[model samples]
Target chain A: MDIEALRQQYLQQLQTEEAAAPPPVTPEAVAQYVASDGRDDVKICQMIASLPLDRETFETSVRALLDIAADKSVGAVARLAALRQLGSAEFRAARFGPFHAEYIDLLRTLATDEDVEVRTAALERLTLTADPHALKLLSDGLQKVGDALVPAAKAVQLLARDDHGSALPIFRTLATEAKGQVREEALRALATDVKSAPLFERLAANKDEKTALRHIAAVNLKNISPPRFAKVARKLVLDENEDDKLRAAAVSAITHTPAVAEKVVTRRFATAVKKLRATTRSGALKSSIGRFSKVFGEG
Target chain B: MVNVSVKFPSYDSQGRAFVTWRPVEVKLTLAGAPAGASNVPVTVSAKSSAGGGALAFATTLTHLGTPSINLNLPANGAPVSVWVGGLYPKASASYGDVVLEVRAAAGNQLLGSQALMVRVRKNADDLTAAERDRFLSALATLNGSGTGRYTSFRDMHVGGPPDLEAHGGPGFLPWHRAYLLDFERELQAIDASVSLPYWRFDKAAPNLFSRAFIGLPDSLNRVQFSAGHPLLGWVAFGAAGIQRGRGVGPTTVPALFSEAQTLNTGGSLHASYSTFRNMQGNPHGSAHMSHGSGWITSPPTAPRDPVFFLLHCNVDRLWAKWQWAAKLHDPADPRSFTPAAGFPPGHRLNDALWPWCGPLAAPRPTTAPGGTLAASPMTAAPGLSPKCRDMIDYLGTVAAAHQAFAYDDVPFQK
Candidate 1:
């Protein structure tokens, strides 16, 4: 529901506290409080949920929760809750259509939040409310996460959700520069879905990528759904002297799409099959063919 | 061969009312002045103003196998002129109007300035106001409307949808171009002014609808209209149509993709605001010079304009371009975007000032206070104040010196 409605509902529930004569504070009250539909109520609930108070003697617990949310350390969640609470209302109130007016400071801070979750949430909210500012912030913040490829990758994913393919720069940074899981995740993230299609396109387009990364991207193309994969796969399969593993990977990837399978299963498929046929040890080829056969539901 | 009736405004010399014939459907066709019949031979060319310039067939009849040459016009409206005799040998007596011009790789050149005039039939004004409104809404939706995607300015999605669908979304250029045309046509349907004073972004901004048209710097109390013009609207919608007095502006490379990059990264604003409000650095809300192309030249429209789609496509393309261009090499590489960066830090979904910099109310940590320091902030390079800071920053810090993201900004030239 919209933030105003949620807030009013939460506040109304809180007002009922006095009418009930205020029984011993219990987890129910705390849960109810956090569950309150409003941002303030949610903030209160999150604060209370993390406390160690018993219902009968809950005064101290509620107080502590409020204090902590107020505290700098717990502020991220507090801000998140507040933003979540009020965001809907703010969005509804904005006068600009096809545009949004900005309220300055709040945006600047949210754009550069310290907590990744809070930052992400803030970006999402900003995307709706203060589009121009949000876009500027995103462009500004791409370099904020260095070496931290997971966060960087996450950032890229978020960017991709916005159709900001420019985030590819960050993805590229993570794909090559990040260590271990970060790099792998970046590469995987880059290959998955139509949004990541650009990443795969780059992989196919770039002649300079590390041979292994290119191979992985080609393999990852296998997981994509339908016509999009087919079009991209066809392009990859046609490139001359494509790495053997990559070519096999392209062949393997094509099996996922029926259209691609139908097209590749012909002379293209035979050529790839023949290439595999030429291999002596054929370790990669064997796996690719195995995967291909399984995907095509071949006997 | 099947014969087709030909209609025209006039006939050619020798009292010949020639309606040259060619295949209607099939690609196979061969009939034009034979290969080498033109020693400085004068040529004739014809075209239909209707039918989007579909190729008209040309054929020649003769005693000796009727030497005929096929003239292929890409699409027809008006045929170009050129003299033929200087290039071909005039061996045949019945050269016909399809005279030979100098052969070139570009296309078949017509040999003469011979003119064929035909009063083209006018298309009926078909779009209604409701249709126009729907078109506007649809255009806005296509241009700026999206959930997480922020394609332009006026696309703030704080709590609810950017309202782009409610108003008009981002398809400002095409929607309006189509809209104005339809409006003119609508009026024409009622027998109103059929002559629409086209906005020549080249000569000057078409400030015809003055009252409704506001320009940049709303504080100026000025309208984009020609001050004395009566047809233009008088109401002001803020500084929407201010900057007038136009000249041919520099060609700009569309940066929709780059714009998308910043919007996405910052989580600051939606696409609408990014496009309109910040047409030039988010200063004057949704007011600025509307971009356009010339008459002879193909006016770039959204989707049709490579700038439009390419920016989005390349935003897509770059993701691909990036995989190979550079992978994250090191933490300080400046190309990295990590989760730890704390994107969307506080969730001020409705806050108009998104992609905000600074802290939320008390307790919200503005900067990533973790162990790692945020890398050096990128800035616009010397003398290069890109309207979108994100592009400038990225170009300065990450992109090579030679790599530049092209965008349209108000030309500072007087």
Candidate 2:
């Protein structure tokens, strides 16, 4: 972060060019590079990159990027290049405090930059911060369909991270109203929401629905209401036309609640699985049933 | 040069005095006293100067239930051994935050005084009001309202590249051991006296489930933290406040395996490491699920709420207690730990654990979220990129095995 020290170090490195030593990264001095108007940006970037950092300065390296990155007058390429350094592999170990006021202020300012590339980059970073502003933007984007800062599925996934209290209302609406991944994501986040028992019931039993979604619905239903899950799991296992994987997942969820699994898993359920396994040849499903049979003590 | 100094008959491998929230005993000794000094009548007392801990004198270690007590030292200059206890400090304390000063005097004639450096990770319910406050303050500060190092820790779990290295395999226990260590080290960095407290899921920890503590959620599963509680502003994944369900309260045991049942998992006291790690499901997963439903139940989202650490700490403790009972700290023994063979790359006994493993391709999760495993000032058993084996033999039961931290119940043995 100390440009003066970097200048001094650059000079020292140039002076000690021993035979085995690699060439100095860039002859362009740091001071001139910072002051230049794009004539020496590449060399300057390389020169700054060459400096070594210990644990103490690792954090400062992140801070230093803020100055170069926030300079609007600077070329977009140079600013973005500086910002991207924060994401470097080694910087993953950097101890920079991401919540520092200056760093946050920089992110807020850039979230709406004129350039779309920079704007999207900043928006993604802001979303990860879990900032309320990012939440609103993401929420609005999901509601308005095409007018989104991020994809609806991605938005659902990010919204799911809210732990459901804040996202519950949106998810409850999406669980029934949204389509495909967004619907599945919304339904998945509601795995613990007891209020959605009916939705879980409807989806878990809808033979026409995709097995993946139905399986998730079954798990969600099982977690919230084990008895309800028991009722559903028993029925799913007996239905010869039901998806094999869903049947397997149904049995898996039942075993999670042994008390419920006990009442629901009867001689009839065992007979049903044996009958289904006879007609089923899918290796994964056959394997799942085998495991289920052992769990139910029918092995 | 007859001065007084505080000493622990027990010490860390470094000869330093370290202790958990559980009581550890210490003694008073005289230095440079004349050879014939006998029946040296002196009054002795101890107190935490920084106000996060307390001291008391008791005849036996079990009598540490009270905040203050009287000690009966010998009538000589000889070293008298006694209990050195913690949890007297106020809440919001950190590691090394409690500097206990033990002083001796002959009726106001100051003979000598010595300061003992100590830290404690106490049960959440047993924490003094001051101790609890310190823990919350330090944790809230670490969270920094959702943008601090805590976020990085939250990311390390749940989702990562190619695999979920922290769960469902032989690596589960050790992976979380190192994970909690990294997190606790970071918390300590915020406040030295702040050690991660364990949430004994088998017991009803009402204080922990309170809104004032980890925050009890409302009817909608929205955590209702007490007014101005540090976590009131908590945010993760763009959600403000914790979205935890009103789970089974501290009263009425949730469906979790007791420590005894969990330790005696394989129909025997000393089960193989593979059989023992099944704890990842019940007590581990079941404890997470016992909350009815919340981020804690799912692997990827569990770390969002701070309770995740405490829940896992008790899990780790169960493992530690089992290790102690089975004498299975030596990883070289096949029973000590399951071999990494046939498991994922990072799951290998000697493979560096992820995130701490830095950036490696395939088999291991990409983009290690929390840099390296934190180095402890106490000892250096687990390095920057610690291997799964490094987390085993936690107390160094095997000679020269690296040691990281200690538990109040699990004593440090040479």
Candidate 3:
């Protein structure tokens, strides 16, 4: 007997049955299926997603999903399904009122779980809570050391979206301290917040900062205020002692705004090119100058 | 029966005397001697060459400022004992045969003699199959004694202390170095041939979780000590119990630390308390927190896990490498003179490491107001204060620490 073939046939048959019957689409029915003995997480998740749940039933459905998500005895796939359902916009909008704290607590615990998928799911779900505890949870997760870091970075993005000022400290720390994609995400998150302009300006101007961090700061600074950033960018481009990568960041940032580009290019083009020739003697800086001239309509 | 033999680790791999172990003691056992042997005066002498040549270095063994003492024999002819101490190799001598002679008190008659060979080599790594087996055997002996005996001692010392003192401050690296040495001494007592093997995480070796070392996770996605493995039945000293937790996903090693970041400056010993200490803590603390869950995840109870020692051994190795390659020196600050709050008087560079007091010891724990332990000295180890010296003496001892061993790979930045 070929057990693999038999299993595939059985799965196809179940899919056919699922298509014909299409599981009930009521909130009570979703909750019932979630709590039922049958361990078909995919079918249950599909039913919950399709349901047009009212606020009262949506709350009830969230309670049932929380139970599955928090249960370590349940398979990871099943728990992840419950978490995704809870993270959905319709379910998140339903007020838990008295159960809000309990719901947040469940998500916080799952955020630190040993399983990576569960931790990712919990982080995604917490982004919707908008509670102060959710912010604290995201901040604490950012400080964690290992695999959860990438997911934590994602959570920071969500938190920054909801309340930029509150997530500023974490963004600043990540911008300077973190490496690779995590750092990029943090810089992007900081740039998205208009309030982070001063911090970005300080980071861009600091000579002791890592070149990568300074570059990100310059790029992000342009997003908040191009004309203000142009002054810092122009200084970086003209400073002979500055790192080449940093000068490139300044050039790239300054070229983005037409007004700022026209003024800085017309003012510093020749001196900047001569400095590049005397110090680096590379075509790289010359090309940047030519690019800036074209943007300023003086090429 | 008359037996004369060199110790189990007669010669280290490089064929030199072990560095940290000084004055390698030679044991002499005598049986069926004459009646007056009980009162016989004996003198033990060592010479550099095999046949009674001039002594290359000092051959005298002394205790309490007195020259070689007489051997005492039981009337029943049970073996009389004479310990030959101070057998370290000279600076220029890579390998030499030391001939030890025992002469009679009156006529200078030869009673017994033996020639011993001494050797030194780099520290052990788990990559070698035999080294791994030896390590597991030593760990089994240490672990079998139960977590309460050893792990509890570490937990109490670090967790109870002048709180921030042992960690997040200047004493972090030095204190942990002393701790690993103390634990290594215990392991040597269990098996003289055993040395603490470091885990070179920079190599990104995937076999660290092999059954020969800490086994990989089981089918349930749980990391348990393998069934029938030496550490399988071992119980945890902390609340985490005996269960092991294996790290998953990307390796935490690269994220937690980079050699470039840790050894950035000829790190100052006199700078702010956070200067070198906090820099070391970046990777050190991150590794502890990144192990996911289990005893290794938390600072206070981390010693309960067997993996903690291997992780710390690598950290100690890095410090040794930094001291050597960077030519960085420890601070001679007089203000760094205060001792650990609860432990003893040894926080200064010249001070002897308290608790494990002996000659050639590491420095004492430095003071940090909030980091100091709150326990009374009376409740701690007795006579601990007297055993410690000032920082100067402590540095002198640790300076020679690598004389007994070296790292297989020093990760020096070009």
Candidate 4:
């Protein structure tokens, strides 16, 4: 037979089998499908979605999914499906009130699963709980690498909505050390709270830190407290030993703070320009100075 | 009257024959042959009871040419000698008694026959300690040789521009696969009994870095061989010098090898092309980054450090394990490349790897002057393409590359 005809026949066979398969009636049957080794994940997920979410069935199904999610031997895809099932609103609304601690514990363990998808699924489930314990779990997951780090950092952001103070140290460490989007998320998280000012000040003043991190800290600090950030920004702009990149960041930070005095900003620019003159008259340096002046509304 | 004797290392201590697709020299000596036997045509044929079945991808004699040799039969008991070589097994060939038959052309009479019980096993880490020692000794011979072949392998990494087509995309795994096979082939040519050993980084094997094996550099800050080491005379090719295990702060290695990252990145067949590539690239790059600086950290100069081979072997082992766990083969799609901007020309499933010329051309030197230190332009070693091959051909070469060897710790399907 030709390839296309064979494919058609195979599809017909699958459709017949799928049509013949009975819908899972009891919670035990659904749990069996969920925990079945090497079964099709999409089919399992579809079955889960079709199951009636009556109170007793919902509790039984939550227990089964939790068991699968906790079983490290299960394949990551299957575990992820289980985690997603547990996170569904129906499951949360049905059993999470009575079993909140057990659910939180399961999520906390899964948040560090060796599989990224499993960890991500657990973190997603944790977010749905809106429990304060998730804040600690999300903060701990920041040290994770690869794709999991992003979600963990994001969970911190979501949790920050309720508890910004708890996420401050986690955001500070991530802002200084994390790269790429995770760092970006942490910076965004820190900017939401005025309490982040002390950490931001330390990060901004850390000359040894990456210029991007220092810049992010300075920018966020300005957003948190303009008057205090303006003083720090002025000191950074006048520091001759500071990198030109960070100095430029300081200038941008000050420009955004309308509360800073124009005279103080002008004085900082004059000191920077004088330092640039002493170093070299290169076109790059001259342009940087010009750009700084422009940001401060001085020609 | 004719007398024939066949000589070769037919089996390991475990009673397995020398592996297939690796060169094994069969020496022949004729004594007391009839006079006027000069320039006699001799032919050798080999057969195996295990291979050549309907489902076999490699036959018993896939690449084994009709072994023909011209021999002058000795007169009055004087010895006549000829060597019959260039024999390799097919990739899909299985364990069996490989029977080699020799015949004289004039009368087509049987001159001699020999049979070897050959069995292909996993990589060297699975070998017995005695077997491993022999393998290490053979590797040392290859490393110590003046043959520009070893230097050429290192130079291939160093001589090219920083972005040579070997890395940073879907081709990274395939390119390294071909390169490792080439290195293995060279080692086998020296001694067919030897195979590349994998270093399991997840498990601490500090002994691998000792002077007895892949000798450590004098200091982490310096990338030179330690004093009294076998590779002390070895010179750095394109690298500034060797630097390893220095300045790699504590966290990177642990972070890179975190269980969640390794499995998530490597364990899924459903991963997007960029996701899988990035996942593989993360640990691969982090391992390089964690090895301190100098050769290990630099793309163009990594191969100058001997540790690079073992590290890559571990990476390859991980790929193999991943494939087995996920039940996924490499994506056959022609468009499987990284989606990131500014990446060098992405490779398709059939794209030719740059700098690795096919079996004909010499490896291209790094664009930078003084990158290569070979006394003369080095040619591609036998069974290796001088030009980089397309992914299909590379897959073909290494499809069963791991068949002849297995890792002790890797959980790959048998």
lDDT of 1 by residue, B1-414 (tens): 111122222233333221111111112211243444332222122332322111222231111111223333222222322211110111111113232122222343432222221111111122222222222222222221011111221122112321221112222221222222222222222221121222212122223122212222221112232111111111111101112212112333221123222222223222232222111111111011122110101111122211122112222222212221223212243333222232232211111121223223433333211111112111112112111122222222233221111111100000
lDDT of 4 by residue, A67-118 (tens): 7667777667666655544543221221344655786888777766787656
Which lDDT value does model 4 have at A297? 40
* Model 4 steric clash total: 16
lDDT per residue (tens digit) for residues A178-218 in model 3: 87656755775676556777877988899987765676576
TM-score of 4: 0.37
DockQ, all models: 0.01, 0.01, 0.01, 0.01
RMSD in Å for model 3: 29.2
Q: What ranges in model 4 sit over 4 Å off?
A: A1-299, B1-17, B20-140, B145-147, B159-162, B217-229, B238-243, B246-255, B258-260, B263-273, B330-346, B358-414
For residues B1-414, write the lDDT of model 3, one tens digit per residue: 332223322443333333221232345555555556454556656555532111111222221111234554343544443433222222112223455566666676676655443322223332455445455556654654243235534543443232233442344556666566556655655544456777654445455656545655442223443222444323333111232334432233433344434433232222222243333333454454334344454445456677778777777765654443333433443232233453233344444443444322223233321222212111121122222222212222222212233343331110
What's candidate 4's DockQ score? Answer: 0.01
State the lDDT of candidate 1 residue by residue for A1-299, as single tens digits. Answer: 13234334433443353233212234445545554455464445344322322212333433333333333444465545433323211211222221123333454455566666555555554442225656555545557633221254344433433333445566667776786545654565454345565666567546777655664454344334334446656665555555555554455445433445664566545565555545524455454455455434442
In model 4, state the lDDT of residue A160: 47
Query: What is the lDDT for B295 in model 2?
Result: 61
TM-score of 3: 0.39
